[model samples]
Target chain A: MTPPTDPFTAFAPALAGPPRLEPTDVSYVLEDTSLGRMLLAVRDDGRVLTTAFAPDAAHEQHWLERVAQRVSPRVLRHPRPTDAVRRALEDFLAGRARQVAVEPDLALLSDFQRLVLTGLAASVGYGRRTTYAALAQHLGRPRAARAVGTALAGNPLCVTLPCHRVLPAAGGVGGYAGGPAAKEALLALEARSAG
Target chain B: MSLPPFQQLVDDHWRDVARLAHGLAGPVHGDDVAQQAWTQALAAYPRLTHARNLRSWLLTITHRCAMDHHRTRGRTTAHEDPASLAQAPVEPPPQAPDDVLWQRVRALPERQRQAVVLRFVGDLDHRAVAAALATSPGMSRRLVSDALATLRLELTDPEDPR
Candidate 1:
């Protein structure tokens, strides 16, 4: 039988689920950065769960949903990002930080994607760049460069994993999760830092 | 295969689970029960072998959560004293001024209330209700029937006992 169309029953959908349901160990900070305002979720263990461009609540919600779909559904809120990830992001944007050392939640990635991201993030030097084909070749999947792009496109850890350094083999800057403009800005920042 | 996205699962079933939780945990503690249920459900989701009885699976988890909520909060359960049915609901009297009906519903035995809620409010059939409450289908049917008969007799004539 259909639920009764009573006032209380009608309001059922609007009632938020109770507290204690959300995973509290993972918290997110949405902050303004040189690239754009971004939402970043970090676990208590300090792993960066995901980073996505968010200029407003709608954008934050969009990225949060994707995070839930791909990484964790237990997202919660924190007043600030983890100190290390925060400092690294801030310093990098201001041209003072050397590395954005965030452990991407491998749970958010597939085996191949995890390996590809790990390889690129660890090996790609700052201020320099490499084609997806070259990076794939370096990782010993020489012919899997297109597949590497597919993996990078779904990268959860964004700039902290330094996926912006992976351009297309055609030489023009390739697609980025944070958009082409943010990608270019990051590369420029790294170049100026490198010199 | 991976489970459906957690957000999608919550969107689809929270209401049903909330109603069931509200019935088990009552108003004051129902929200807490619902939240804990979701937490446990999400953690156990990946291990769920199949989705054949997702509603019952969730309700079963919610049932345990509600029970735990009551225990941790030191609330009374019908198991404590079957005779204490007098501790019935006290809210919504002005709204459903004839809401003496809900109060009496609350006055039923604990198992009976659960059965009534699953049958009428949850709209679950005997088998699903049984799976939800971890009882046999036949017993679940009997519990609902007994509760309905009791309600019909006692509610129609508050002074009479059958």
Candidate 2:
């Protein structure tokens, strides 16, 4: 066979190369659930990073940017890292599994948010519900109920962290990142399973 | 076993991939070939169900990407500077430090060159080389031996009888 006259000319198209990506970049996967599309993002160390209920393209973009800002901006979509947590969340939402035994990386949250969310995860169980004021009191911040509400509002781990289990001290289910309908559905599912 | 993060794969094998790229596509195009392979790997990562050897999987992608680079370059005008193309290796030298031996290996027929590079530069076993080259393990072993034998003859002193 004739050796090519030159080696440089044939390979210039890819010479520009693909965009740079780090080996420790964050990765995510999107799963369709009854509530909406859920995005499960994971850190490079293989811990659960953040979960979001993306109702639309814009919602998905917003969560991606949020992760990009808080974590490494080198996020890419790959399912292997988040597969276990994704499966657990799926099972939990479908009432097939009672618990998601995965740990969310709390380092992404503010100190106050981390404190409240950690308290909630430890104190709450499936089919159980807590009032925002009750959770604040549990955290020894009886006067910080509204602050707890704010912290929970920005709950990055969402269902995995059991933020849906927090209701209003008033007589109704409070807001959820996945919307009120999803909140109610999750509560009802847990109630049926628990019963 | 579970697949680790894609980033982990990149971190683990990037240097090997770059070396293989240089061996296959020459120094000038090696980085480009490696980057293109990784970009394609990232795009297709989710669809891959089982990868018994991730290194082999990655090397296969790099080989195909480099080959694609060669084919595409065949169609384009050969206007790039030859002096630059033949410049000193951009990547660090492989285990075999003899530059003349490596150049001769590069000039070998494509299959022999690929088999030898996968065996040495990519540090893949015979089975892994077979997987990357899409050939039988026996064939990969034969190709590697043939390339090595030729290199031994070419590099040894022609007048000195061993």
Which numbered prediction scores highest in lDDT against the true structure?
2
DockQ of each: 0.18, 0.04
Q: How well does candidate 1 match the true structure, expressed as C-alpha RMSD?
A: 6.3
Badly placed stretches (over 4 Å) of model 2 are A1-24, B1-162
List, residue by residue over B1-162, the lDDT tens digit for candidate 2: 234456557657877777678767776667878989888887776567775787888888998999899898772211244565555344333333344555677677889988987887777889988987888999999999998788777766657635
For candidate 1, lDDT tens digit of each residue in B34-66? 888888887777567766767778887888888
Candidate number of the best TM-score: 1
Tens-digit lDDT track of model 1 for A1-195:
122223223323224453444445567777777888777777767778777677676767666766655655555566554666777778878887767755667766789988998898779978879999899899999999899999998776778777899888777788986789999999998888899
Model 2, C-alpha of B29: deviation from truth (Å): 8.0
- For candidate 2, the iRMS in Å is 9.8
For candidate 1, the TM-score is 0.67
Query: Residue A80 of candidate 1: its Cα lDDT?
Result: 56
